[model samples]
Target: MTLLAGGTDLMVDLNFGRKRPERVVAIDRVPELSHLEGNGHVRMGAGVTYTRMLAEDVGSAALREAARTVGSPQIRNAGTLGGNIATSSPAGDTLPVLAALDAVVVLRSKQGERRVPFAQFMTGPKKNVRRADELVVGAEWDDAGPAQTFMKVGTRNAMVIAIAGLALVVDRPRRRVGVGLGSCGPTILRAPQAEAFAAAIFEAHGWDRHLTPSDAELKEFGRLVATAARPIDDVRGTAAYRRHVLAVMGERALARVWSIT
Candidate 1:
């Protein structure tokens, strides 16, 4: 079976001695695995690169924006969505976007093929998974509501890792909240409380009339996002600071979605 996806993690791991697999099958140049096709449920080849993600007009704006934040034009050109999941990085820029969209991954082996949800695919930090003989071919996207955006806090921009990152997908239809933290904890996560809270808050404020949410409500929603984070104090930042960033990011995300000052 082929182990393909941007090769960012696999190549690095092999080089750094973090991991070494005896038998390696590359799918980087496979035409069938490099195309992004399908509708209603967007089916992407596991080999589709980040550059493809940034350029796609079909997917949500949030995903495109998040793709823009990935390593660089070079990295985006090389990285694949399947690679992001294979790396099992909680801070993968596209990961939270996938989670917020409730994406499904297609895994195949000599035995057969199975579809797994993004949430279930990510078992933990730097984990979840494929056996020695299994292949992760591609992933499919679902619809996320309107006015979605992605934000991340790092030492700098361009190619820096996320100290804490968030993707807010807002809509009256499929309201979802995906928060991805880098160097914060084990895995990327969906903020259920924050999602539910934001939905209720938005419902209370009314999505149809465009009523403004009060500062208190906004701050509370921010707190919920913060509460959902599991950041840690590392060389780059502190847990408290990470929490603060989550709140500020969440607030700004909400504001940006609404185009409020």
Candidate 2:
């Protein structure tokens, strides 16, 4: 049996005869999966559509920006965040944002509830650890703040698969930084070395101060981010090109988040 929410990815599979599930359960209208709430932290239901995310400012700035680039208006209206999580596509626009935020996936089963870190949720391309009996109800994360952004390089300006995407977040309170990479790996990847390098700079410069990293530092950070990618040569782009795109996007995303000229 298969579950259906937005039907954006699943419908494509069905239409193309890629997936012929013996049973398909529609859960788009389940009230429990449509809530969006936030205080110091945010909890967005799996059924929350990209359109809703953009209108309501559901997650972070990066998330809102990613939502804005998802697809056509109609696709945004139907494509749900939970559906994106369920599909676990490497190129899913919001995946990198979620990774940068360190969001927690909330899965519910008849037995009880389970929460999994976003890092551990996706095991491979289009695969996750969700059990057959589990339903991905929502995702939750602490507010990162305004110093964050998401950017992607695609074939065209709109409605195109990303060649590479990057999400960068700076947590002032924690004096830490995060970089999430997409469309350059089998699964969304966090750039640990790049994050550590940025955090070190933030520590030295003072988190509250506006400090511009040297060109060499910025370039090295980009290189570290590029090194984390596990890409393959595909129709969208080549592995080398993806790495280059990731490096550029990573550097620009960090610079943008820092408000650097």
Candidate 3:
């Protein structure tokens, strides 16, 4: 039983930790866990590189867009979505996208396999997981929704830690707003209040399907999103700034979803 992904978080921890495990194994080379298969319901290999994700014709707006934002081409070439989930960093590029897409994680062990929703798999920052013996063979998602958009605020445009990042998936019939906050709390946050807030706004305005927000509605929505954040001021930015950025980004996400549709 060992942790295997891109080895990013594990390698880092092992270097810093005094107690090193005596036994170790790497399954990154497992061919079965490295291919993207299944179309009706998407199944992503645990070792599927971000480079593969970006290059694939697999047209998931959420995954496609996220693949582009992941690290440098080199990092993307090395990092895996399974690694992102395994790391459980709130700032993980793929996480907000997965959470918004309402994706599922597949965990496997010698015993068998179990699937957990993305949100449930992510209990807290740098956490949420499977047993020591379990391997994250892949992830699965269903496309019963609208196109999506991903947003994040880092010091620079790319290759930066997200102060706050959000993903919005709008399937008019199942209209939903999924928000993920990084570096704001121990775990990525889901803004239930903000979701309802946006839903009300959408409901009141009628299902235009092309939902547009007035400045008032935008501000109100932002405030609700702001409340969902549990940001702390650090070297990167301030809590107030995180709240404000998340709000602005969220509005942009909303606009993008509409435009895409």
Candidate 4:
């Protein structure tokens, strides 16, 4: 049975004659998968749309920012996070935020329910770990707090696919840092080394809620973020250009999140 939520991706392909399905199971109306719950780890139902995220406090600064980078108002209203996760596109704006937030993908089937880490859920571009009978119920992750940011570099300012993207999350109280890269990798990736470096910087700064790293530190962090990516040349951008832009974005995101000029 084909699972359908919001039908944004499915409809796009169907309308363009890119896909033809004999049958589909509409999951968007499933009440269990249509609500948001939990506080520490916000659990968003698969059917939740970008418009709803922006309209309400979806709980993560990075996620809300990423949601804003999605398609226009109409698309945002119709496109669901479950669709984006299930579609597994490299340019899916919300995936990077999920990665940085260390999200858990919740899957359900006739057999039972299972949870997969966001990193392990997506195998490659348009590929994921969900079984044929499994349905994506939702995603869960801890709040990214106020210091998180999501930035996408695209050919156009709006309604454009990202050439490169970055998501950064800083938890001052926990002195933790998270980084996710998008559009420049086969699947969204976290820069462990870069995260570690940033965490150390946060500690050195006394976990200052407003601490901003020095220029040299930011540069090194950006370099590490670039090094973590395994990008390729594509029509949207060249591998070299992606690396360069990601480096700059990493620095800029850090500066923005930390309130640095």
Q: Who wins the TM-score comparison?
A: 2
Model 3 spans > 4 angstroms off: 15-19, 38-40, 144-146, 201-208
Best-fitting candidate, measured by lDDT?
Answer: 2
Q: What is the lDDT of residue 115 in candidate 1?
A: 88
Ranking of candidates on lDDT, top first: 2, 4, 1, 3
Query: Cα-based RMSD of the predictions, in order?
Result: 2.5, 1.6, 2.4, 1.8
Overall lDDT per candidate, in order of appearance: 0.75, 0.90, 0.75, 0.88
- TM-score for candidate 4, please give it: 0.95
Task: Provide the lowest-lDDT 10-residue window in model 4.
Answer: 204-213
> What lDDT tens digits, residue by residue, belong to model 4 across residues 1-261?
577777878988989998888888787677777788757769999988998888557888888888998989988988898999999999999999999988999999899999999989999999999998888889998765678899999999999999999999987756688899999889998999999998887777666656756899889989999999999998999999999999999998888887521
Model 2 ranges with Cα > 4 A deviation: none
lDDT string for model 1 (65-123, tens) is 88888898888889987788677787788788777777888888889998888878877
What lDDT score is found at residue 79 in candidate 4?
88
Tens-digit lDDT string for candidate 2 (1-261): 899998999999999999999999999999888998887799999999999988645758889999999989989999999999999999999999889999999999999999999999999989999998999999999987778888999999999888899999898876778888999889999999999999898888888888777888889889999999999999999999999988988788777777531
Q: Model 3 clash pairs?
A: 125-186, 125-187
The estimated TM-scores of all candidates read 0.90, 0.96, 0.88, 0.95
Name the weakest run of 10 consecutive residues (lDDT summed) in model 2: 252-261
Q: Write the per-residue lDDT of candidate 3 for residues 1-261, one digit (tens) a residue.
A: 456567766777789994387776876788898878655567888898888887645436777777787778878877887888777888887887777667899999889999999888877767786777778887887763545767778889888888878777664556665665566767777788877877776677664455556777767767777788888888888998998888888777766665445
lDDT of 2: 0.90
